[model samples]
Target: MSKGRLLDGVSPIEGISPTDSLDTLFLKSGSSTAHSPQSLRAKPWPARPQQLCKGIRGWRWWDSALDVVVVMLPIPFFVLAAAVIFVNGKIVDQEQFTILNHSIKGATTLFPICFAAITGRAAIKFATWKLEQGTTIGVLEQLMGSRTVASALTTQVQLRSFNVIGLLMIFVWSLSPLGAQSILHILYTPVLPTSTASSVAYMNSRQQSYSDPRPSSSFPGQWFNSLAIEMGSMLIAPTEVKISSMDINGNVKIPCQSSLLASGTPDSEGWVQTALMNATSNGSLVWSSLFGIPIELGTKLGNTTFSIESTYIELSCNNKTVESLEPDGQNGPRINFTYVSVAGPYFSAEDPDPLDPWIIGYRGVDITTYNDTDGSAYVFPLFCPDCLSSNFANKTIEAGTIAFQEFEGLDNANATTVFCNPYQRYVESEVSCMKTAATQQCQVTAQRDSVLPHMPPEITYLSFPLVALGLSALLPNVTPIHDATNEVQNYLVYDPLDPLTIMGEDNSVLTSGGSTPKFLSDVALSDIETRLGQILNAFVYGSTWNASIFLLGESIDNLQGHEFGGKNASFVPATRADIVAMIQNQTAAFTVPAVLRTQAQVYVCNFAWLGVFLFSTVVMLIGAITGVVFSRKTIVPDYLGYVSSLAKESPWIRMPDVGVNMDGMDKARLVKEVKVRLGDVSYVYGGYSEIGRLAFARLEETTKVKKGKLYV
Candidate 1:
């Protein structure tokens, strides 16, 4: 190889072309001297790069300033909006609202990150300048030096798409409705003071009740017995009784006073005693004989026993009113009484009638069989008539029967005294009886130490009519009285397992395999029954006459009156208007205003416009970041080719085959040769390689330089 032609068939260009020397040729012809290479070297590069649009003033500064303005436009507006929201307390701590607010705030930081990404092109430019020792941009500037500015202009136009996209993203981030709505909400739709109101949940059908006083152990037990004393006297000398009275509306008033004598007769005790004797008899002959034999053997313990109780029930009127004597006809009533006792198969402390009035209370009676008996007979089981009869007992009483006698002055007075009216003034007595076949062996005698003087006891009956009266009084003209009774019920359920289950002590369990059973034993059931019976008895037997008089006619609306102790049965001292007023006040206690009725209330933190503004601002920032990361071009490393060492040793000029045609060269062979010669030579300066810049720059340089040769 020749020193000047180290590569075969390659040589350097001889000299510069006359056309490129036109500027110097003209200058030398005019000034009589040509510029030396030293003078050219000393001159500065042109202020603007050689490009198609270099003469176009204001492009670079205008473009850059517009981009910066758009990116920064939303900053102040965003700050103002956030400050208003925070200061006005519209920035809620609630997660639902704050999620949107956080997104808006996050978008504010995206601007700087996205701007840095877009400016990666500047980093590329700086790195290329250090490597290539050039002031202008890489390939385009080199081409612009020799070609018309249009070629450089074309290359620059390629980047306009990315720039336009970035600008659009910035514009959206700054001027979107997010900020506008925030501003509008702060200005026009500010927060307002919230009002609180309430509503009512009516108890449509409810009840009120009162229980009675009773003995502690209302249920029958071995020692469950109560004693009550009744001993008082009263005299009413009114000439004539007031049988009934009514208010202005014709509603009856109770407790009319009367003065008429109905005293206990000499035979009253004897009659009561006879009834008690009959009631106490057991129908079994063996039992009767056994009882009589024991009493006869022991010598008549005593004639009989007597227990008498009396009390004066008083009723005085606030306003003095006329009083009257009881009539001497069927209309006038006298004292009445009854007695009952039960004998189970065996002597067990269990009441047959749990609701019986005498179970937990005292009723006056002249008991003929007061003495305890030791029968020598074998008592057959009760509730078995056949067994007793077969055993010569003749008859059996399943449950004990009652014997009663009611005597009124009118019935046996020969047209001289009052009548028998169980509902009004009457005298009554009773004793339990049993009949058996014993030839009257068992005998009993009874006597009364004293008797009652009955002259129609003073009675004060009260009729509440609470439900209908309340409704009719409040809505006198509108709402009609309804039988709201069935709509509601006073339900009390005994849940034995509730407490156990709540405490997690319940034995019952359901598992994947099976269920475990837990139940109350018989003893538990019996104990429960006993307790329940006691409670019920207290509620029943301990109740007072006054309570019944006031509560019995709760829903009644009619004004007609019934007799009670020669007076109205259902009545109240207060007028109907007053009763109605009481009901109104009671109903008012359960009501409240309509607006303040929610279990929990949640108030809006601020206006709706502010939320909209926040959401829109977040969307714009995301868009800008998306464009920066995915759309804009940043630098990378690759190259078209490298200079061959053989070619660099000599001056060379040759054109490689373009893809359009390989000219006579084998395409694969040529490609291999180019790779072998150029693969080791990289565009990147040590440890720094930008594949995108090098590849693009090398292609442009190769096309312009043509076989890697210089013209001058």
Candidate 2:
């Protein structure tokens, strides 16, 4: 072969010599001088491969350390996300929550890109290592360059490949997407409803001082007005409020009071025992009412507990028959009704005639009363004059029936009359309250052994009679004495002196007189008992309301002469401080602590997905470390897949034999001054003219292939 031509049968260029300067070759080939080989050699390479290597052992410690750092960069970001979830458990702040979520998404997205760089380099280095070990060209091609999952899969199937190292390289590449998805699921922020601690305010009636006492006659107008308003509320309040006020299980709730006495019957155990009534019986009285003051003004969402004192009524009744004044009345017509009176053994001696009686005569249409064929009258009386003094003294009062028959000829035969005794008591109770936007509810339970001590005699004497007399005056029916000056029309217009007159005789007068007359016979026994219980409830509840008003230090000047005093005229009103001291001493009031609930967004981690992410990260690190370990065997710089590296070693081109093992970088340093082109480098002439061959070669040695030229 000639000096300028290495391949056999290849034609030499007409004007080029093996010793010609590269500039001359480029000028003859009409190539630009801007890209001349000398210019290419002038540019400096950043780091020499020899300098990067630690003697013959390949890369230095710092180089490997840098690689480790790049691979571990994702660890800190993952740890930060984990730490946020671990510490806060929930993120309530909107800005911080959004920032954390976005940061996590960005980190997961970048994970693939970062992992690809490390693993791609590892793949190339691994291929080079295999090549040095004399692997087949097919395996070398599969591992030589940056590869996608599709390309890796195609190569795996095309070679029917079982090469473990090639499969491992493919697995390492697959981790890019896997690790990204795993990390994406590791940290997340979602909006959810959560209960957080917060404070709120509510009206605590139990905390109010209640020991204050005012003269029975003080602030009569205000007292009467308060009493009237409270009574109206008790009668007309919403059914739900009324129902929530009482605990049927014998429990007590704050802000609400129940008149259903405790389970036992009146006995000698204590005053509380003496106050017990059979609430479960058919004729028992049970009344419940909500306090006029609400527990909380506005809606607050949470649950809390508190303590309070509840005043309620308890009554026990027995059947009895009154004796007739006339002997022939046993065969006369009958009348049935309910009545209230103050004529009992405990009546004050100073005021023998205290007040008018309350009478409710049946209009003869209710189930509570029934008539027998024989002449007879039945009257159910709910009265207890000594109940106040007896409860104050912790004694059971069993005053026999008071005889006062309105009819003359009718005997009290087979009568359903009842002699009922009623008393009031205080109980210490715990309350649980729940509030929402739409509703508020409370649950109360009477504390064990929580019956309170009786009010002081002066206090009870001054307050109880006033309550009784006030109730009598405020009630619906009050029959005045015939000799009185004020002529009040009674619903039953029949003469009280005529015993033969039957009830409902004047129906038009009773029904059409602009009054809704109620008949005991029209009401169920249970309902009648309920109404009676409510009346008793008013007596005690009114006293509490009066006490509350007194404790608040309101002026009571109007009540000076209206007192219900007799022998108890020596009683003095209590001061506000006295009430406060009494309440504190008795521990009758309690302060409750409450918290509010709210909704917020929280940071949550899926530990299962976190495990997968950690596992993938670990696998990636192992692969990168493996690549670094194998790189020690690489004798030349990393240039295995570069087109420039392949160009220098081809036998078809005329180039100097520098060395067979030189990497692309080393070979480029030696041949950068050479100019190259793609064209026809070989051709022959024959009887039928041989076709031209095309390849990359020196510009002076090869001619550009014409577009229409027939060459193979």
Candidate 3:
């Protein structure tokens, strides 16, 4: 309250003093600074709640730009990576339809997105903290001017924790060689092609796939049915990720390729007509898997998440090379480093640059040693940077140990036939593992139409949740509450009056209230609403979004003269549905939900309903009680008291509580008052001492002051 600057290191905290001038004192920023009225920044975009969240102009624009780029850039970048890789081996004379490339491309789209997500998330957090720090300091300045700097510094320091954590997460993910190695290894790992159909139809797995060059073979309606059910389940009920795969199995004997027709076997009504209807008239196709991984299975019909989906599965990868075929099986490879280049730099046996990041040495697979005669083993930069001679030397001989069925540019018949046999060819297998992972592990074999009737179709439950939620509405007896309670207890009936309340809780309330049935008791839902919402999301939103999309491409092909085709005209060859029904008539799909809740909803929803009243009522009371209790018991008074106490002290004297002494006061000693009395002795400003002699000496030339205080 005094007009003059307050005392130093004095009140509120004993033995500790504020600097007589703010520049000399130290104060903590952050929650402590909220007491100051001036430090807080006013809201921006007062009209929109979201915009209002962006308190600073600089921060707002940057966030918007970050979000936009994060959302948009990955799509094009993914396209570019695909375009580059897709035509790598295909673009010689013309291009061939290799759908696998597209799938590989699609999966890869998420790689960049992951990076964008990390960058966006980190930038957003940092910006938020910076903006908040400013706002906090501003508010503190409003309450007490001298403490502003200390408060600002404190808040900024506190918030840096978030950025540190975020950076650590990014660093861990990016730098983790193991994760990258696993993924890259997977990319290079060989994949073998299996018949998409079934092996049983082959009569044996030891032969080449039997192809069905059928013009009449077509899949049928159960696809649409499955599409509808799975989608319905997704839309109505909740869902989750049960990473699984179906292992289908069966056999078929087709008379000829033209007879292959594994279409619409289950009929619109859903039936499994086994025992090939006509081997001569129409060959049956029994499509199924053996060692398949079911990502998703089962179907959700109408209101209930009445889906019998999959056996719970956890991800398991087989990284170990099968010993039976591993190169080491014969005799763990021994690298023979016979001096290939005697004259090159580092002429010693160990070539410094020769595959510094060495390649794995194998026995019978593709092998390339130094081609001494051709000098093909010369060392060079892995990624060519030179304009000319970028492929300075032949670093790798692509045809190491591979034995191709046909050879185009080779003189020796045996050399071209085998992948590579640097040493004399022994009894080792000719071909290297089929160069791809996912393709290798999973074997798909096309079945005979007579084997069952059609290919077993896959079911996507995108619409399951909608059906669950909507049908839940329809079941006057099965509102959301009823169904949930019924699931819990058979005897429990849903009370329509209070739809939110379960029958059990309502009964408890009724009995307790002595017939004046309480509106709702046992109303406590869960603080873990986000978790459950996430669960619901897994069941609901995720199911809807990620569900194996039911592409009911309708053309004049089948069912009611509709053009069952794709979005543009891209063709979809198989409909796994018809094949599924052919396998089992009563085999209803197992539907599961996949959804998760986010942090934002929790903040907004509660704020939307509670409004200021939430804090105005309970929060303030709790805060007041806490402040009173804490202030009395703790060292250094609580926030409210600090505010009130600071109000009485003059501004220019106090400083933040950080361990810095700027005010030139004995920080360890408390002071009762501060005064700048010109005692004809020297006066101190910052660290400078100005006496009669010193003042006269320094300001001899200037007369900016009107015989009193210096103006500048």
Judged by whole-model lDDT over C-alpha atoms, candidate 1 comes out at 0.24
Candidate 3 per-residue lDDT over residues 363-451, each given as its tens digit: 11111212345533323211100111213233333221211111111111110111112111001000111112223211112222222
lDDT tens digits by residue: candidate 2, 5-98: 2233324433234454555544544457663555334444343323334224545566668667756765765575466657455545677767
Task: Assess every candidate by TM-score.
Answer: 0.20, 0.53, 0.16
RMSD (Å) of each candidate, 1 decimal? 30.9, 13.6, 38.3
Task: Look at candidate 3 and tell me the lDDT of residue 512.
Answer: 33
Question: Ranking under TM-score, best-scoring first?
Answer: 2, 1, 3
**lDDT by residue for model 1 (238-337), tens:** 1111111211111122110121111223363443233222323421110100000000111112112212111111211111111122333466432221
User: Of the pair 1 and 3, which is ahead by TM-score?
Assistant: 1
The best candidate in terms of TM-score? 2
Question: CA lDDT of each candidate?
Answer: 0.24, 0.43, 0.23
Q: Which candidate is the best by lDDT?
A: 2
